[model samples]
Target: MEQDTLDLAHISLRPFQLSDADDVMVWATDERVTKFCSWEPYTSKHAAVDFILNITTKFLWCRAICIGDRAIGSVSVQSYSGDDKARAKAAEIGYILGSKYWGKGIATKVVKQVVEMAFVDLPDLVRLEALVDVENVGSQRVLEKAGFQREGILRKFLFLKGKSRDMVMFSVLSDEIGA
Candidate 1:
């Protein structure tokens, strides 16, 4: 399904534009922001521009998490299984927010919206999953608040910042959301 701009009370999920490179760099370069993320901290505006031009543009389900006209973060849903319709429909969700916007419940709000869109608006999707760094308590709480149940830990599942890291898996099924 096409991802249109999603409006929320304090933030909006919109397509990333090349002009947002500066705003994106504001958070992308921060060491704290990339501490637990899979990608290294962006070292220049060119890197941010490349991300907008290359990565975000190629993914139909990725969006810039915005407040007003500023792009502060991103969220995406990716198919975990290939084009096999008979398999249980599933997708993995991932998100990141500028540290300044953290702890304000914005992530939770964004997650809840994505959950609704996945289970209610999209009929083919039966489950939505998230893998968060074990040290990221804030994100863990956000997933729990959004009604995703903690499934288990994925040991050395992701290599980030030059080291292997463990991740906690969480998921919410369509029926769990009353879809």
Candidate 2:
């Protein structure tokens, strides 16, 4: 497939809708897209519906990455709850793009947008972090290019797909925005 430069003007981030199910499936069911994600590649449309209606609703802030009116992927900032005061001031950002859109500078651009949006939308938020699988170089690069600092790695931090994995920790503080 011949890759073309994606016009940034065409990219957008908006709240997810049930109508986006078909477009969600375009990436949610692709292993290449889900390889580094915590969830498995969805096997059915019902799962996509479940995600849009159930899963995304739980996020502090979530949006479908769109081109025109079509959902191509998602980006979110999830807050850590409970009585942990330290965790309350921070949120974790997560994002995924369609496999066809990989290497087109889409994820990096979207991540940068999410960082700016998250900080403005969540006033109490002092930090935005992202955890990437050690093997997912593309994702790490995306975070770095978006201005997140590599804080180091967490060994065996998460058990996914039947194995414990090491993850790289990256973060950008609210004061660091545009710095």
Q: Against the true structure, candidate 1 has what lDDT?
A: 0.85
lDDT of 2 by residue, 32-133 (tens): 999988899999999999999999999998999988898889998899856888799999999999988888888999999889888998898998999999
lDDT of 1 by residue, 66-162 (tens): 8888998998887755666655488888898888888777899999988888776668888899999999999999999989999999999988777
Could you tell me how far off, in angstroms, the CA of residue 17 lies in candidate 2 after the best superposition?
1.1
Find the candidate with the highest lDDT and give its number: 2
**How many Å off is the CA of 145 in candidate 1?**
0.8
Kindly provide the TM-score of model 1 when superposed on the true structure, using C-alpha atoms: 0.88
